[model samples]
Target chain A: MTPNERLSINQATIKYAPLREALRVTADAGITSIGLWRDSVEAASLPEAARLLADSGLRFSSLCRGGFFTVPEGRARRAAMDDNRRAIEETAQLAAAGAAGSAAVLVMVAGGIPQGSKDLAGARAMVQDALGELAADAQAAGVTLALEPLHPMYASDRAVISTLKQALDLASPFSSSVVGVVVDTFHVWWDPELFEQVARAGAEGRIASYQVCDWKTPLAADVLLSRHYPGDGVIDFAAITHAVKAAGYAGDIEVELFNQDIWDTPSADAIARTIEGFEANVALHLGSLSGDARP
Target chain B: MTPNERLSINQATIKYAPLREALRVTADAGITSIGLWRDSVEAASLPEAARLLADSGLRFSSLCRGGFFTVPEGRARRAAMDDNRRAIEETAQLAAAGAAGSAAVLVMVAGGIPQGSKDLAGARAMVQDALGELAADAQAAGVTLALEPLHPMYASDRAVISTLKQALDLASPFSSSVVGVVVDTFHVWWDPELFEQVARAGAEGRIASYQVCDWKTPLAADVLLSRHYPGDGVIDFAAITHAVKAAGYAGDIEVELFNQDIWDTPSADAIARTIEGFEANVALHLGSLSGDARP
Candidate 1:
């Protein structure tokens, strides 16, 4: 199958796998693209990781992330900025190695409320400022920065931008291709305005990427679940994809899972199952619909 | 303090307490209202339960719940309907026993996905149909049917009405006084349209209840933290309360905590600490604000 659409693997699902092993496993799964994270890519080093993906003809869909700008001054914020700069440079290197795109999207997980600040709005401003700086670097490198809106559980500690509208608003000053929102079903399926927001993202050409997962119950009331899997829970994937497609997005559809159960499985097996699940969950939706009916 | 506002203690917070202890402890807390489960009230018998609330001068702000209307067959649906009727009768008994104006708000926790059914839309329709029947009964008894939209996580197996807008839309055919949304901050805080919805609820006089609690994080992937104290987490209570007040909701601000931590504590201690936390959080926010801005 010379698949016209692209399938990107978020490395977190097989987080336990070595970077090279993960690339090999993902490649074997027939997923065309892979999203890389700082820690994992750094562990493998950019040149070595690039060489491996090059040898395998794998695509770097996007960089895992670059943002945590809500620290209260001093070292952490500066360190985060420096780290983000490095992420851009790394994305540039990955792009140089034949990833087949003018710019890879630099996904930004906006930071949360700063310590001692009940002012969430203020922290949001800090994210915007950080993004402004990163956008300049990203623009220079011909890379896009995708701001991901996490679930509300992470609003205070992980991301202040917790909705598509919120992310779009923050990225308004930038060109759609320079900065945009990642429509992750795991984070946004519960949103009442999800359809409208997805439409908005599409209209503005702000849909940076799309991720799919289901939300299950008996959720631990303490930590946010990164443990979502497609079809294991209840997310209206068919409905969301239809909306996203209606909005004119022609980008890669990425599957990013954060489940302990999936990770416990062997990387090869996990990768294989995930690819199967993705094809079943996403492809079936696409396949069932006529091309004209997608939107 | 001749408290004019309605203050209901949801039984789940004191789930460990014998129904009797919950009543007496709630009374001692100086809160006038209590929300009881049908099972608890039925177990205690209507007369004895009435006497318990009467002796303590406690009121029934609402029946713990009655609408799990998404069952597939005649048997389960009929059983749920009958159970709701019994809840209404028990609520009338409480009203007759000097708990005047303390009529029940039938809190509906919509049932989850039917085993072997992917029809969320169908389940939601079933809930609406059930509400049509229950609303008539509740109206006749002078009780309000409060459609408490569970968080989206519960949309499948709990209440499919996962948003204030959807709940309000369902209740539109009924009088606003008879059908309303339970404004639970824990469930609705992350909603980008919260303020707008609250205004709509208040405009229609459909704010049947206002439940408060923090949205604690680091939640385990599968379980929602039902038990949370107000002002203890990321939710912006000060903002929500301000919107509720501005919407003209002159009702009791009920403290509904589902945390196991609170339940394991002595009922008296839990009640005492909750009251203190409620007051302190309000005061902290109040003092932090400028001018005569009221939240």
Candidate 2:
């Protein structure tokens, strides 16, 4: 049962699985690529995780995250920058260890407004400042820091960057290779400027990662975990996938669901469902994968 | 105690109150203006509601709503348009019945994506079409159809228009008086382009209403009811209120809360809290209201 050649299972979609199990199940399911989260990588230790990933023979699509840079200038801020630098190193090493076509991309979630603060613009500026501080390191390590604009619902407590245009504007100061943006459908499908921003991100050559998940209403009590399998929700994947393809994003497209029910499913079954959903809702619009060969 | 002379209590802040009781509580709390919901007005019958509002001697700031225009062309769509027309007539009558400075403004929530349909763009176009069908009637009644862009979380199930810029763009082809946009803080506070759009709305003379409510995360189980009283959450009222004021929206500033807790509070207590929240979080930034006298 071969999954679409471009399909990459984002590990968070099967959250309860550790790094070894996640890689084993993904590869066993005939998936060629996987995106890893920091927790699982740290649990296995970076070197061992890289070895496990190498044995699994799956391309490393991206590291789950790297940024929480909205902290004010202080001990906490210094700590966050240091942590991000470590994440950049992890991304570089894992991408090196994976099969051919691995991508050295580190997804960044600009942390919400600092606690006790209502200055959203200031928090956003801190994200800009963090990017400036880290661009040189990311470029040196050949890791693209992919700034992810989370949905506005999480603006106050999860991420201050809430639109693709805002993410692109923040990514403007650095080189596209060093600073790019993540176009996660769940976070951005509602954006009126989505298609326009997708085109702009494409023109700028900064579409570092394209992640797909579905958004259904009656959002879970924890809105963070409300994403569903593609085709299980109302997202028009045909349009968005075609737009991303038109944007020239040839990297492995990642399916990243955070729903609790999906987590309870056996990793193999989850992978099976993901593959089916991807083929039905997203893969059709991805065009042919022959030209998608990446080193 | 005099509430800010420009403060208006949106009836939804005290959802249980009947139209007559809502007016009584608001006026009894020394609030000089009110924004009425259609359900309560319909409950009292429009003519009787108008009479009660007049007897209360409070200015009518605006009507609570008028649009759910995202339905596909069918009997449902036709019914929605007709309902909106009645809403327009209700606004005209209510404004006339209130004290001087009443605004015949009808707030419009562009309905969610149609059931089982994934065509957001198509649904939005339907909103544009509905406006075209209703604009002349609104103009004929001297009523402003105020387009309210709900937050992106509600984009799929509640409102497809999720940003002030989108609302303004949709309102562009119509006269500002006949078609304007709502600057509701809860719906738009997370927008990165908010200040810019507010200024543009001002320049276009399209800001028909300015409503304020705070947004706290860990949103209610039903996201629609998560609104908080001002100053109780992370919203920066000073920045937003100043932006709205700078944008030339001198109309009544309404406090519209939907939280079950706020709704359960006694009507008089809720109005008192609304007044307190408004004074502390918003009114200070509004400058003196002496020059804001509008008829």
Pick the TM-score winner.
2
Candidate 2 chain A, run of 10 with poorest lDDT:
A286-295
Give the best candidate by DockQ. Answer: 2
Which residue window of length 10 is worst by lDDT in model 1 chain B?
A: B286-295
Model 1, B236-295: lDDT tens per residue? 777777777777765556777777677778998887777776776543443322332322
CA lDDT of B8 in candidate 1?
65
Per-model TM values vs. the true structure: 0.90, 0.97
lDDT tens readout by residue for model 2, B1-295: 6889999999899999888888889989888999999999999998899899999999999997888898888899899989999999999999999999999999999999999999999999999999999999999999999999999999998899999999999999999999999999999999988888999999999999999999997889989899999999999998888878877888999999998988888999888889999999999888753332111
- Assess the local accuracy of residue B83 in candidate 2 as a C-alpha lDDT between 0 and 100: 93
Tens-place lDDT digits, model 1, residues A147-219: 9999766776788888888898898999987888899988877665677888888889988788776677656
The per-residue C-alpha lDDT of model 2 at residue A283 equals 88
Residue A145 of model 1: what lDDT?
Answer: 86
Error of 1 at A4 (Å): 8.4
